[model samples]
Target: MNTIEQQLWEYIDGDLDEFSKKAIEEKIKSDARIKVQYEELLKLNSAFSALDLDEPSMSFTRNVMESIALAPAPVAMKTKVDKKIIYAIGGFFIVSLLFLFGYSIYSSNLSMPKLDFNFNFNLDRYITPTVLYSFLFFDLVIGLVFLDQFLRKRINKEH
Candidate 1:
């Protein structure tokens, strides 16, 4: 808007200092254009003041609160699971198993029987090419499933 309109608005809103107010008042009186603009603004202000503001119903707040309550709570992407505690538990089990195995071996007499390490293993009888291929295919499928789950989890975390 023009400077005149700005000054007129400030004067109408009673935002100007006494000196500026006097100056604008004199201008409004002397200038017909300013006088007309001032009158129009005054009428507009009065019309705005006369308007009946529409208010929401008494239950508006309650309805909004109820809707908000009905919404599902958001899930956090990362929950704090102490990896150190998990590792400690797993380490304890592994150490215990090793200790038990060593104890059992020690309890057995030191004069143990000498056993032959050589064995005549027949791989063709149990693991044929078809069985090997099927096992590999099964492993591949399981790997893909794990990969898919990992990617889905990563995508969910990013979002």
Candidate 2:
């Protein structure tokens, strides 16, 4: 709105200081345009004051809540993840570890070592098939636990 209308509104609302109020009153008396506008605003303000404010029915809030309750619960984004992808990744790591273990065993020298120590340490007696298998199983279990923890941390960071 123009400055004249704004000043007139402030004047009508009794929001202006004495100096500004007196200045606006002088303008309203002298300017025919300002005088007409001021009258119109006064009628509009009176009409607004005459209006009765509307309130919603008491059941309005309850009806809205009930409708919201009828809708399905939202599912978490993490819960939507495909199990097959996780299983495939886990399987790949397991197969890779198994291949690496097999390669290391195949390339190692199983022959007896010449030792100068008084206590004879025989490698063959300790490095049996059962022991190797147990070691590999233990490493696989530890790897799976670490992978699980890593995946959980990564998932939490993403969300």
Which candidate leads in TM-score? 2
Candidate 1 lDDT tens digits, 1-159: 999999999999999999999999999999999999999999999999999999999999999999999999999787775576567557656765875665465445444247734434444466566975785686577558656766887798799
- Poorest lDDT segment (10 consecutive residues) of candidate 2: 113-122
The estimated TM-scores of all candidates read 0.47, 0.51
Clashes of 1: 0
TM-score of 1: 0.47
For candidate 2, write residues 1-159 as lDDT tens digits. Answer: 999999999999999999999999999999999999999999999999999999999999999999999999998776455676688668868877986776576556455546533433445666688987987797788679867977997899799
Model 1 Cα displacement at 120 (Å)? 34
Segments in model 2 whose C-alpha atoms lie over 4 Å from true places: 55-80, 99-111, 114-159
RMSD of 2: 10.4
Per-candidate local distance difference test: 0.80, 0.84
Off by over 4 Å in 1: 77-159
